[model samples]
Target: MDPIRTDVDAPFGRIADLIALNARQSPDRLALADAQDSIGYAALDALMDRVAAGLQRDGVVHGDAIAICAASSVAYAAVFLGALRAGVAVAPLAPGSTPASLARMMRDADARLLFTDAAAAEVIGAPGEDAITRIALDASAAGQALADWLPPPGTRPFPVDVQPASAFNIIYSSGTTGEPKGIVQGHGMRWAHVQRGARYGYGPDTVTLLSTPLYSNTTLVVFFPTLAFGGCVVLMPKFDAAGYLQIAQARGVTHTMLVPVQYQRLMAHPAFDAHDLSRFQYKFSTSAPFNAALKADVLQRWPGGLIEFYGMTEGGGTVILEAHLHPTKLHTVGQPAPGSDIRLIDEEGREVPPGEAGEVVGHSSGMMTGYHRQPAKTREAEWFAPDGKRFIRTGDIGRFDDEGFLTLFDRKKDMIISGGFNIYPSDLETVLRAHPGVADVAVVGAPSVQWGETPEGYVVRRDGHAVDAAELLAWANAQLGKTQRLARLHFIDELPRSAIGKVLKRELRELNPS
Candidate 1:
């Protein structure tokens, strides 16, 4: 495959520059929508330009990290793009994040300016004792407040000849260790991913529903595809089952990506079947693996609407499950995307054969800039292949079938070995979730005096439905091998999730405490 290349001088030096170019090409086209309000490409471009001017007037300059704490709104987008236009890097903090979390992240990132809306202001507060400039968007006037808040003239624009490797934003991962690590994304990585998304039928005519929170890297992948195509992004203030369907129908949204849990909730809503989704062209899902039954259910109901793509936040890694393979090879996360490479290797670092599970390694031009200064961890993740190609170890385990399709069986870090038998939680959970009464389920290992460790199934029931533990146990035991069957079960209202909606098995294990 040819190496990824970026067109820096064609327009804006970075992804933000695409906004101005789109404004000129399709000025009157709707660029973004939030609830009932919408903005055309020209209006959004002009508004973001003003924000850039204002930031310049306030002494915000290139290379500075400005913290933006606000809900997903056009104003938030303006501040994000404006900071970039002024050559400043942005650290978009979750609006309602706790003080300690916010403080630690701000300190770690060395953010010098803070921007927030009123509600988040109450939680995050102004940059009081901290060495940072403060800017607040009055939620009372909506996002238009930025337009009237003028900047003095002659604000210098960033030099157009900047390097493509320049830092654009500092995003933190949901650290399993309780302290997040900052992930530095460069202009080159951003453009590469944007172009990859464009190849998936995203363009000027596309309309995407921003169902996930903007702070999520997943949202960046979804929303920016539309932006790259000069298409409209319909942003919801927050996710609600009915609200999503209503917006999709109302705005004629063609594409969306949601967690399986969100899709389940949407299907549970009374108005779900009432909405007309025939216009829906593409519906992709990730953040957690979905059961084959769920894929079959969607395909049987929506025909050609569903596509599954697997990705990780760490290395900009992605694998798109082709629509043609769904329900046929339902266990796989599809094949590697264009301009990418994937391999499954064993402990001795040799490539594994078909149907044998091994660690998944990948290479992409869009990977982060070595997890923002953690040289040791970055070096550990990156290694040169025998063919002189570099690949990042994804920390995931999978296998390839005879047909060359990929099947993700487990996370290498999440595997459980019980009584000398290796067991994958995903293999068990996929079967458990197929039970009609089980709405969602997660499988983990629980300590046992006899077996050392046994599989535990944490299940959430469907609304107004109940499952007898022993009866379900009998059903699972009869179908699964003795070692793979659930040794215990617990009912819960909802499973704990990270912001991006992945099941937090670590928390589940902690709570159960064997």
Candidate 2:
């Protein structure tokens, strides 16, 4: 059976048609804004046609795989949409990822061509095991070059039919466990997810201030919905607390999304209190579970503005919590999105009842086709149910309430089986953060000879707040279960976080020797 088409056509309606619609309807309206400058819908549409022309000229044919490795810019979007129009599969690599990682992704995704900006061209130009054709993506020159190739306002659109099930883009895994797996986002799945998200709240009138990197699935899902709804996007090439607030005020941005740490930083910023941020309508956060304390802090400051969604890139949005519902269900990730279903199942694949912890499995049209080339993993995630429906087994573990609100319990892999007892690190970290001197904490399962594997607490104290390791350990042990207690303590000045401020526990695990 075919998947549902949420939008006018399929969400994967030809990129050419979508761009042309925006150009015709909102020609003069601003579509993209960044540190450099803003570009309107008409200008962007014309530029995309040009990019498409250039790709065609370069021998890029339909179904060609292209790598987009660069920072956030208007040209980046033009190239991405242009590639889609040209029927090329896009694989966007993170800017900060090592060349080794980049090579792995390119090879894994079987990308034959790379489209990169000048800044990171040197890094992305390095040859891998498999040779790839490199093309320079000059943001400044793209519009002109495209115009040269096709002539802006005169470039002929490609005569191609891109089906919804056709390969649209490849979103790589976070690589938290093993090498990053490329998630296959079909033209239809991408469109369905974007439409579902936009219909929920993200719309044309909304001004989305993006602080996350362009490579992230969050950015991919958010950007299209904002554009489809005729909303303006203010791009933060890289996240900066002070800069974000300034941009929010200067641009009169109505909506934005950030990880939990970014939210904390915004609240911590001294200027946060000085600014009149009443215009801010909705703020969404994910990538990590949020704490009730942090939610309270944001609510006390911004009132009804916080929104949360629970889902990863492979699947689009699963659950959505609005600002109004947030107060009633503080820790819940909210209810399932429309046309989506969630189930909690045990390791043996048995359905677990409400209040019982199990793996969170989701089913929706927005879910990716599969992990690129990893047939084994794909088969496991996208399996058939007894009801003849398809479902993806999210590695995450969570439980539901009687009211149907979901609360994240822990990751299936991250669960510490200490002395036959299952312990969730998040539970320990939350308790540790309650202490006055403790600023932030992460709990990991360290190998233990006696109990097989035991939980270890790593804490970063507030500046100028000195607490002895013994005292901190004692306090943590008092609050935790006998099996969940920290085997040891590692006091660090600061935790190494990702571009989005997610604590890199893998780094900590590598840094701290067993």
Candidate 2 lDDT for residue 508? 72
For candidate 2, what is the lDDT? 0.76
Q: What TM-score would every model get versus the actual structure? A: 0.91, 0.92
Pairs that clash in candidate 1: none
Best by TM-score: 2
List residue ranges in candidate 1 displaced over 4 A.
1-13, 125-127, 140-160, 324-327
lDDT of each: 0.74, 0.76
lDDT of 2 by residue, 1-514 (tens): 2121234445346545665676787799888888877898888877777767667777777777788887887767777887787787889888677778888898887786676666666665555465676655564321223223444465755766788778889988777776788998888877775666544465556788998977887777677777776678888888888898888888888878788888877898888988767777777787777788888789888734687878877883388776455587887888998878888788787787668988888888777878898989888776455787777887888888888888887778778899889898899998888988888888888888889888888888876789888998899899787877888888887887766566777777777657
lDDT for each residue of candidate 1 in 193-287, tens digit (9 for 90 to 100)? 67766556776788889878777777887777678667788888688888788888887888888887787777668777788877777788877
* Number of the top lDDT candidate: 2
All-Cα superposition RMSD per candidate: 3.6, 3.5
